[model samples]
Target: MGPTVTLLISIGLCLDWAVRAQQDPLPRPTLWAIPSPVVSKGADVILRCQGHLGSHRFQLWKDGELRDERNTSWQQAEFMLRNVDDWRYAVNYSCRSGQGPLWSELSEPLALVVTGAFPKPHISSSHYYSAITPGTTVTIWCYISPQGPSHHYSFALLEAKSLEPLQRQSPTGTPAAFSFPSVRAEDTGSYSCVYYRKTAPHMASWPSQTLELTVSGFLPRPTLWAQPGLVMTPGANITFWCSRPKMSSLGEVIFTLWKAGTQEPLQQQISAHLWTSFLLPPVRPENTGSYSCTYMVQTASARGSEHSEALELVVPGSLPKPSLSALPGLVVEPGMHVILQCRQPPKTFLNSLTFTLLKVGTPQPLQSQSPAGTSADFPLLSMRAQDAGNYSCVYHERMAPHQVSDASEVLEIWVTDALPKPSLIAWPGPDVASGANMTLLCQGPSWSTRFILHKEGSMDTPQDVSQFSLTHVTPKDSGNYSCRYQPGTNGSLWTQPSDPLKITVRASVPSNTLLITLSCVSFLLVCLLLLAIFCHRSICIAGALHRDNLKRFFCCPCLPQGVCLPHHAEAPRDEALYTEVAKERPSEPSVSNSKDPEGVTYAHLNLRTLNKRQADPKETPIEPTVYATVSLD
Candidate 1:
């Protein structure tokens, strides 16, 4: 038992502890308040730390700040925090286990947001807008308690309906403002915000109250017209027209007409145009009310709206009756003017009145309000047949309970301006091709019973039909043409002369020039057709022959010169020669000469022979015959 043995035991103990710690890895501990996290003032609470591993030491932490550390090998540890309810709020708790010195990863954070430690945040706005215009920038404010620690928590702005976060902010202080630019309809909804611990982003306080946002572009006020004029008698039908500016690209506008003191609208309509008419049949005193209207244009991504000022409908009982008369004689000719005068009973305060003149079968009336007059006249300029109808007038006081007078008796008038000038037009335009059929159409109003078509020079006798047709129009038929119409066979009543219409017939092209052009085109087409046919035949012939047969028949004259010349496929054969020459020289010469620039050799043979050695003077006998000429220079 010396010092060496003692040191060996110490090393063995350290190794054993390290091995056990690695096997278990120091389990993470959980902390919980003894009397629940929500408590009153001056209350004492115990933070009980528990874990699976029997650790030797436990450390307590509040809001990521270490509180206390105790050494004990136990399954549970409790640290008492007294008088926490006095000043502490929005506190977070966590714990970690330790084996001797090494510590485990921190446990999940617990948010102990005290019951009354902090005040709730409130959502506020300065102007409190009911409707906002698109593309306008807006800001919203969220105010919280002023006593919270800076950077202790972060803020999250969320949409309340969907619970989706729109923005997040790091806590610097209380009362944070969020800005939205180019606001659109999609931004319209309920909004709320919450503050969560910075260390534990998930643990958050209660959400603040929600605020609403709306997007609306400025829309012009709608125009309201009460047909038969706002002052109508009972049992008479009237229609209201609410029209606004026309916008082709906007969504369908929904028009709502509401009467005062009514919860629901009296009428609703959806249309794409700027105008909508609401008809109220058989008007009664009960239908009288101060009516106001508004329009809504809603789309998938945005919304727009406009509202009209209110108007009061006056349905009056028995009262004074007015008289109506035409200024000029009846039967007003076309282009002539006339006036209808309505004379109401003279009153001391005539300016406090509104006068309306209406015609039978018409929806609306001509309304006029004079500041100091008892008579109102409606002028009819350039009178026409449509303007000829029964007419009447009425008046109403401007005070509430709007006292209206009885309508005057009907006055009949006639507008002789029937059958407006007929329009003369030519088919296929005013210019016509030679020998082509042409038509002249005389267009007049439906009331016109008869139409007459005339040429400029033949106005005395005109065609009696509405249209004049020429099967074959020649140059002679081309002239100024016009037309007019009569009113229902009343020949005395006729429309003014129509604007002059001229018809021009063009001459035909020369037949010889046309024939030459056709001939040239035909010639070119024939050449192209021949070339195509030759090419097709050559391709068929070429493809029919095999590679081995190409050499001999390649010069096959049937092939086009273009194919054989460019490819050089038909030329001389490499195996044959055109000429041959041969020459024999004696190796042994009969005589030898010197090797010089110019030399010569001589050869001789016996002149006579018999058998192998016989010789005759006339015949030479030799193994071979040879002749040579010698020269030296």
Candidate 2:
């Protein structure tokens, strides 16, 4: 009985001890993964679930998912992965201790790394050749074929030559994209990329194909061309030509046209022509805005050049008309400046319109930029009579060349510039002979239709002629003369007086010259009369010794046939008979005293008439001419 009791007590004590030991804490173990932290591709690796607790059975879990379990007699239990390339070998790992079909608290998670499990991710760019414009944003994406789960891939962009990485991004799905902002020219060079899982950070694929990334300066800007003209009308069809002034490469170009206030812009591309063309089927009033353009080389993911200057386009509806006005006075005078004003509604926008002045019969319209308040001023200096014309003005849009308001009421201008001072000239000299002809000439502008010649004393009536001519000029015709001209129909358009031209008229000959000529003629006639009387007396003494011969010497009229008739048919037969006749002759008075009548030299008288024949007559004696030689005593 005593022995039985002792055995039972001992059994109870043993049971108590066993029960206490069962209540003790299970083993908190640490896992030993063979080839942990980094593992080779396709290499077998083992996870040893070991614990300080007595139980040898264990379980393994990764990222909260059960990976494997095992129960063995050995204190160290191992879960083997035949091929390390399996996804399970590349994830977070942990172990716990327990019998079969039972589990313990999971051990702290263990991170594992599998090397050479994946090839490098494919690297590419948005551009055709992985080129980018400096100082612009660019995106590089690393792609893994057969895309993996989200947040499973980590990507890096590395400089190939240096194997240096700029930075890393958050884990993402396959084909992870990395953005580079404000890229610079120095970033250019050979580049590569690779990707790995967060769990196996050290394990990655081979480097992707090397990509040559080129960073370039800003691209050249393209030019914009609009159809028709800068000005346009509403609903007008227009075309635009965009081009690069020059080309340095064969790569294509992208062009974009931006509207001043609109979000969307027109875009186009070209690879061949230096220029590109775009067409607008029809325009609208909403199209009124400033337009500009920009461009980039297609090979460079479009870091654009600066935009062009904005070209204003306008399409006005129900625009206000402009009014025309003259400054100072409506009637302008020559040599004075005239001011013309064009005014539109003050409420109208200055940028939307321009002012213009139009004259009737004028081919060109005088225009100016719209003033700040819709008014413009024009000055017509040195007004002319020809400037007189119907004038008006209108408001028009700058962009729409032909779009304009109705012309304002006509404002007639009477320019007096044509009434310029005339020039005068005299023909035949300023001083002239009395009987000569003279002319006064007036000259002015060719437009002058009328001319007037005026004399100083005869101002009351001016000669209406181009040239004033005086025939048979006398002293009365000599005076101060001037001329003026008129242009157009303006009665007040007569020109200023021309410079005066002085003239003088003189008589035909001088009095002193005529008096001397008459006296010389009278003296010559007296001398001729005295000589004639002397000759007649001499002839009387020689003929007619009768009473007629004694008559005082007085000239007798010529006898018939101018022969003195010899006064006798026969003369005295002898010299004695002639002597008697001479003695009987009457004496005539003598004037000068010196020799008197004897000095006359007629005292010797010899008269012979032959009654007897000569003794020896040659060729029959010719009768002597009946003559008597008489002497004056």
Candidate 3:
């Protein structure tokens, strides 16, 4: 028996003693229970073991390493876990009596399943059930089991259904939280997260409860935009567009447009992701109204956003033409009261009325209003020239006060001063002579009927005279003449004096001188006429005398004795008378008669006559000489 055999014998005896000691039931083995096998990391878990008797102490071990030991007066033993990890799972633990070489039998293996690391970071929003404004920030938190220890955690966010990667966050301490800044509409969707061991990125755990993180506060604000501003002309193209605010993601937005106060929306379902616009190609006149729009999110938890302010629309049309009128049309003179009336087409309200009185060339305004109703007046003073001018009035409806009325036809007024003094105007100018048929005319241009002509410096008052005239104007008629005109009984001032008219009268021609000249010319004419008549009578008288002598001498011889002698028979008486004449003759006649030879018979007869003359002077004895002379006869 060497040292080796002695060692082997000693080891066998010790083993037998260990087996007999295990069979002895003086102190029973303690059993430890790991309560709540599944637990999140960084969380506290309890390992509890109880004994049938109260006189026992408990100790906890993991992989045969001492974790905790305690002496208790009660039958229960408990061990608190500060932090849990993957190494702490499937641990063998037991309980033992206090300070003794005796230990309890090893209890059954207790398994722990850590369910939390960055526990599926849940994303919550202020408005979780409704849409939110774009460009707003939201916060999400990572939580684990309530009993877990505080530890650092790393988190990530992903699309819920598609599992598309969205955002990742840095590691944070226990109860980790993350913030999304300036979120957009595209961020609106179903979202989820997971937790992983800090040192091992590939060895990640499943999400807790599949927390449905519906990200909000990322919806676009609905916009209202239209074509025209105030007036939308008929037949014009008008378009309305409903869109999200600019610089926002289109995938997260849904647009719907509606007219204000209308039950039916103008655009029913507008998916901004498809078109991003709601267009009304041709806007009609009837579509004029107030309009607005709303926005929605495209996530599983759909929600509606706020509406936009209303925008007004208007249409265009032509305005109607205006009309005008006046009150009294008869003689409108200064100093006489009259109204100027204006009018227009019948309308709802009297908005604008304007009245104006314009002189032909004046630039000043008389009167003006917005919509004119009836009339205006011009009071009468003593009518003057300046008051005479054209007058008119006009008006229109209230809504469009700027619309003007058609100008009325212009009217003219006649005004006059009191009766003017009568003044005379001569046709052939000034001076008139006497015995000349002169016309004296009395003329007054502005005289009011009653005109009187008077002599200047005369004692008599003015006579009711229309005109003054003289048949033969004399010097007496020459004087200063003045005329005045008055309207009524009261005599007014006299007119300016007429220039003095001088008339001169001349003497008449003598009657005798005029008759003498007339008689001399008449006598000469009568003498010439008488001489022509005398020549015509002389020729006839001479022819008649010659015929008578020839008939007496020749016809006497052929006649019978008694008839022929009878013609000379009265010669006896003639012879007696011849004897008497011969007796009276002188003897001196014989001497004178003897001078001519042919007169010898006359001498003898003369002597005889002388002798008988002497004798007969005394008696009738001279009959013998007369008988001889009678025989010769």
TM-score of every candidate: 0.28, 0.27, 0.25
lDDT tens digits, residues 232-344, model 1?
66998888888876442344778878776578888999987778988887976556556777776676643444557666675654558777888775557767788888888
Q: Candidate 3, after superposition: displacement of residue 527 in Å?
A: 99
**Per-residue accuracy of model 2 over 38-132 as CA lDDT, tens digit each:** 45577677777786545767778877778776677876688877777665556777888864323457788766655466765788876655457
Taken over the whole model, the C-alpha lDDT of each candidate is 0.65, 0.63, 0.48
| CA error at residue 577 for candidate 3, angstroms | 99
Query: Model 3 segments beyond 4 Å from truth?
Result: 1-139, 143-153, 158-169, 179-189, 194-210, 213-221, 227-232, 244-255, 270-276, 295-303, 319-633
- lDDT order, best first, reads 1, 2, 3
lDDT for residue 90 in candidate 3, whole number 0-100:
31
Model 3: how large is the Cα RMSD against the reference?
53.9
Candidate 2 runs further than 4 Å off: 1-218, 233-235, 266-271, 283-289, 309-316, 324-342, 346-372, 376-633
* TM match of model 3 to true structure: 0.25
Looking at model 1, the pairs that clash are: 132-216, 608-615, 608-616, 609-614, 609-615, 609-616, 610-614, 610-615
Q: In terms of TM-score, which candidate is strongest? A: 1
- Model 2 CA RMSD to the hidden true structure, in angstroms: 42.3
Candidate 1 ranges with C-alpha deviation above 4 Å: 1-217, 220-292, 295-305, 308-316, 347-351, 418-633
Candidate 2 least-lDDT 10 residues: 546-555
